[model samples]
Target chain A: MKNLFISAALVVSALSVSSCKKDDKDTTPTETTGTVELNMAHRWGMGADNFLLNMELVHPMTQDTMTFTTFKYYVSNIKFKKADGSWYVHPESYFLVDLATAGSEILSIPNVPTGEYTDMEYTMGVDSLRNVSGAQSGALAVANNMFWSWNSGYIMVKAEGTSPNSGSGSFAFHLGGFMGSNNVVTVKTVNFAGNSLTVTGGHTSEVHMTVNPAKLWHSSASLATTSSLMMPGATAKTMATDFYGGIAFDHIHE
Target chain B: MVVSLLITSTNNNHSPLFDRGDFFQNMRTILFIVAISAFLFSCKKAEIENYKEWGFEKPSHFPEPHYKFENNTQTYDRFDLGRELFYDPILSLDSTISCAKCHAQTHGFADHNVNFSLGVNNTVGKRNSPALSNLAWYPNFMWDGGINHIETFSFAPITNPLEMHETMTNVVAKLNASAHYKEKFKKAYGSETVTDQKLLKALAQFMAMMISAESKYDNYVLGKTTFTSAEENGLQLFKTHCASCHTEPLTSSFGFANNGLDSDFTNDLGRGLVTQDPNDNGKFRIPSLRNVALTYPYMHDGRFFTLNQVLDHYSNGIVQSSTLATSLGTGFNFTTQEKQDLITFLNTLTDQNYLANPFLSEKKK
Candidate 1:
């Protein structure tokens, strides 16, 4: 009995010592920090007055007089390619660009990781996953007026108003689709002139891009023939294709 | 040395008696609890299984579904939470009526023998309570085809004063008041405070997971069995006459069509209310025929009480209209045997498996 008691005591003493040691080990100090930001800017084609939707502009190519009053589209999934060749994607990233709002036109994303970024990438329209998923919040919120109440999809891009050639007084185009032939989600990439952006020791930088609205009508037939588009169809396809193709990397500001 | 020895002896004498065995046991228990807590917390991150993942499960012969599960990834937890909220009456104005009230599982999640369903305060709805199944495969919702996206679909029913009679703000407030709902919201969406966004997401999660691909017709298509001669002939007739508007697999094309309901607008403009175009004067969304046997009387106004009347309208009662479907330009002519056969074919869409599926039923806990 005495031997058994001694053995029990030793085991108890060992457990106590080991548990305390573990408790001390768990409290070890460490620091982990990273920064990421989304920088955005807007640019118009040659001799365009600050880019407003539906403002009458004489097309250089077709020489047709068209007045556009509304131009808006969704931009989401901002990401940066690191020097290590991996991408750091921003979560729940969505943006609505109304050419009317100057602030919205220049999207600034802050808190990006301090690293050397080789390239920047962004989506032109809402992803397919967000389209089918039910009600959303933040930039994708229904209150934003970008969402269609009756038809269950985001108006990824809305361009409306009237043209002189068209007989009708108005033209409205709400373009959006996330599946099959109508899927218009485009991913764009920008390499900093073969030079990497060095973000080190908590520094801020800007990635500038030039987006031209004129390209929206490149492949889309003249405004006189098809002046309005409200739903996903052949017209939406032509306009979306032309507009998405027009997005190019002008230069990096920082 | 003399002073240190004296101090040590005094300290030891004043201290209480200590047992190494008891001290270690307490430490071990505490350490074990901390370890378990850490493990559980780390496992709390949301995953694909957190939402009910429903893919297309239609039979081979059926056409590809319109609702392709596009952006909404399926998961188990999201579906479970959606199902819970669907049956819970906390979403209504008075906390009395729920979606399941009008749409019960026994009647293919439709109403109980009523053409127009009763909403909050016993108010009557404008249209009939259509069956709720195979919704994920539907391109459009409602009789007018007003709503476009599946995510924004719940707003119409929730905000319709004659329906739930509750705003999203009020529903979120009610959900936030209950500790049970808070707990559930945290489990499903990683938060305790319930918002309209989360509520809508959860509800959609439940509604979208409702797949109604299992039926007699589905079985026959899968080669599990063969259809009766009457059902087979009816299927052929449907392929020729009805399938254009009703479509297949999901049994609806989700487009606006005027089935010659009237030669002119009488009361409701249906799809015209949205477009405001004179051309869309009398169009309405084509209703799915998945559970047509149970979800009657037919049409947006519930005008027909029986299948024979509906067939009659298609056969000889088509009124001429500018926006009428081109298929019904003249009108179909069917005999007595053909009508009976079409009815039999409609019966083949009744999904007994879906009606009795325990997963869709009220969860006990």
Candidate 2:
């Protein structure tokens, strides 16, 4: 009985010693790190109505009554600027925000250093480097159907819907380009309006941002004029610009 | 560890002699643990062997390859798997058209003397299948520079409606179902589960190694041989007339150019369709002249049947267009002798070694 008790004690001590060694070997001191969740609240039109798939919604600008079946886009290369003029760039920050998946709307950026961020910067489309690079996994995987199989570039923004105003009875706009003269990749920065976002360790903070889908046709023609855009070009440039430009930071929740 | 614990518990029972049944049970447990650990250790060794770095020989004269295998490290096993996939028709919807169906190893990896290759169900395609040699050096793929990466290049043909017409998801499922492929995948990727990334990377591994830098022209350039006087004259003519677009050594800029193929540009917008730039209408990627002799049915649409016809098109048949190449506006006014000499020089680019390279050929079962 004494031998068994001694053996058990030795085993327990060995396990505890190994675990302590592991904690000491960690690359980053975990106590000072916190997670920042950027909750992208998507809405339809200018009225900020709830954006739901398979729901009929009248366009605020075009006045074209439409029922959206699919809406998804890529948001990547997230960076937060500190009050000290230094930037904390998130590594491998690529997210495919699909309307069908509720959790995809909330992009959780973990391991952020505990600090006050004055501005946030993000790219609306997948960067040119990743588009040219071969065979990406996770959100950038080809299984997601966001990538063009033939052209080999990400469809930065995809909006498919049915409309009575079109001759084909449907509209599909897949906008993307990542090369010179044809690039639609946009980088936008939001100033936080003098309110610094303080990320405390062990506490999750949310940065709420609003997206307006109606801005896609803001300066472009109605669905009746052109219902489909499978490849990137002039119409894609205008539509993607308007839509990407419309994304704005609303407020932050501590 | 469990066997030792069991032995300790049995010893603690204080029996005068060890129970034969308990002893046998403990032996069996020890054997099982040994077997499991041995299997796990072998798996770890296999994984290390799978990722073992293999060097690819790049010719001294040639430029650096566009694909450096950053994500998918090169291994012989992965390359072999890619070769198997390239020749296998299992990736197709009906299990008929593999990548090799359109891209044969012979004839410089282009279709066999056909203007446009037939796909699954004998369905004719719109564009001529381009040669597949020296792809590692190509900045972009296809005649329009549509595909950007060598790894993702197979996805176009595999999923194209007129090509293999199979979805990536379905391909993965089919590969998973095959015990032969499962074993191959396990050997290559350390997992029997197949993925689109693995499949594409494997294909890229095989494709990236299809180098064609041993042509007679290459020999002449490297001072290993001498070009005939006529061939030399033709080379000079080519340098003065065509080297701007069809750059030297590589014989391709891999950039889109409006070579005056069409004046209307209505039927197929070509690169313009991809770029959406009005100025880019009637533009197509300049093809490599590495094995131009074998990869006949030339041009994007394979409009020209013979090299003579191609030369004729350059000499007198250039159509005027708004987006016409500035150099090609006035055609190359060459005499019949000059044309013959140029054709001779072009023929010297036929790399017989590349055409009959046993390494790139279909692996016979």
Candidate 3:
């Protein structure tokens, strides 16, 4: 029993030594770290109404009647700007925010060092590096049906639904391109606006960000015009930019 | 025969039996793990003691591999699992087409003279199915070089509409549903729940082992055999004319080249579709000339059925294009004797041992 206890202690120490070398190293073990949840409160355009699947709604911009069956996109490379002027960069940070999956909208950043953060930054879609890196696990796994197989790259933003405006009676917008001329991968930043987040130990801070799905057709045409986009191009870039650009940081709960 | 002797001599101690000797030496340290395994009732000891026997090892002549087995480490269980998956039709939507259907071992891992391989539900594919060997050494995969990694290569065929026409989610679900696959996955990765990464990594494990370095040319390179006068002259002529893009040792630099296959780029843009660069419009992957004799109907579209026809194309049939490879300058205009000699040299690249290796073949149920 004594030897077992000693062995268990040894195992714990070994695990600590190994985990210290892991890629998800934003803070050291000794540092007092706090968790931050970027609660993606999905909303519609213009009036910012409730955005839920299976619910029929008219697009504020395109005015196209649509009922979404699936809406999923990638959020990756989360970072926090420290008050002292440095950045707390999280490593291997990737999340698939799917409307159907429970708790997927909450982008959780754990083990963030306790500090006053003035800004939060994240890539709207997956980075080009992870897209070309091959088979991945967790939120970036191919099993999630987010990654494109034929032409390599993540399907950065996918919005599929049954629409009356569609010729096929259904629409699927799979937007992604991490290459030259057509790259839609853009890094977005949200300023606290002097309402800085106090990330303290033992308390989980939540940041509510309103995501307008209707903005996908803001600059682009209605579903009646271009019903589907399977691959990335100018149309994919325009629609993705509109939706990603319109995302606003609503509020924060300390 | 000499190739197997050299490889065995170099890696004789990599057998699983060697681990047993290390086991007794480190028994005191790993006693806790053993006790825990006993408590869990899963004795992994029965799992092949050595997968390192089939671990990725570069040929003495070849350059360093591009895929250094980054995440998916070499293991027998993984290779076996991959082999099963490679030959299994469950990857297709209706379970009709397997990877082996297109890439067969007897034909140097290429289809048997089929220009375009038939896929699931009698769907004919677009591009000619290319031969696969020494894949670990390849920088990129497919004729277009679109797939950047070998681990992700299987995904393209599985999800392609004209190919397997299956979703990754559905494939994973199918794998999880199979008790045989679940057991295989458990033995390979210690997990009953099979994920796409595991599925891909397992396939890569089998593919990475598809090294074809036992050909007569390899033997000649290793100083184990001699080439005839025609083969020797052909080798020198090849070095002077074709060795720039179709480089030595691996027989390919794995670079993209518009080998003057076509003048117009309206139908298939080839590499341009992936890069979105019009300059790369007609360029396709300059394929390895290894096993060129068996991998016919040749070229990206299987345009040439015979080696002589391919030679004639390179010598007399090169079309003019902006993206044409600067290396291929208006046909070689090879003499009849020179063409015969070159074909003879190409025939020496057929690795019969690699083609007939029992380990790579599908396990009979």
| Each model's DockQ score | 0.26, 0.57, 0.56
Model 3 regions lying over 4 Å from their true place: A1-34, A82-91, A113-115, A162-170, A222-225, B1-54
Give the lowest summed-lDDT range of ten residues in model 3 chain A. A22-31
Clashes of 3: 0
Cα displacement (Å) at residue B105, model 2: 1.1
Q: State how far residue B54 of model 2 sits from its true place (Å).
A: 8.5
lDDT (10s digit) by residue, model 1, range B1-365: 44345446644643432457645654664465566556555454323323223333554565665555444455565667788989988778887888999888877887757778888999999888778887766666887776766668877777778888877777878889999888988887778988777777777767766777789988877889899999999999999998888887677887889998797786888888655567887898888888788877788777888899999999899999888888987778889899999999999999988888777889887
- Candidate 2 CAPRI grade: medium
Which scores better on lDDT, 1 or 2?
2
Q: What is the TM-score of chain A in candidate 2?
A: 0.91
Give residue B217's lDDT in candidate 1 (0 to 100): 86
What order do candidates take by TM-score, descending? 3, 2, 1
Candidate 1: tens digits of C-alpha lDDT, residues A49-76: 3555655676655555766777788889
lDDT of 3 by residue, B1-365 (tens): 44345446434534443487756644643464455546445334423442354467788888888888877777788999999999999999999999999999988888868899998888888888999999998878898888888888899999998999998889999999999999999999999999999999999989988999999999999999999999999999899999998899888889899999899988889988877789989998888887889989898888889999999999989999999998788999999999999999999999998988877999999
Error of 1 at B145 (Å): 3.2
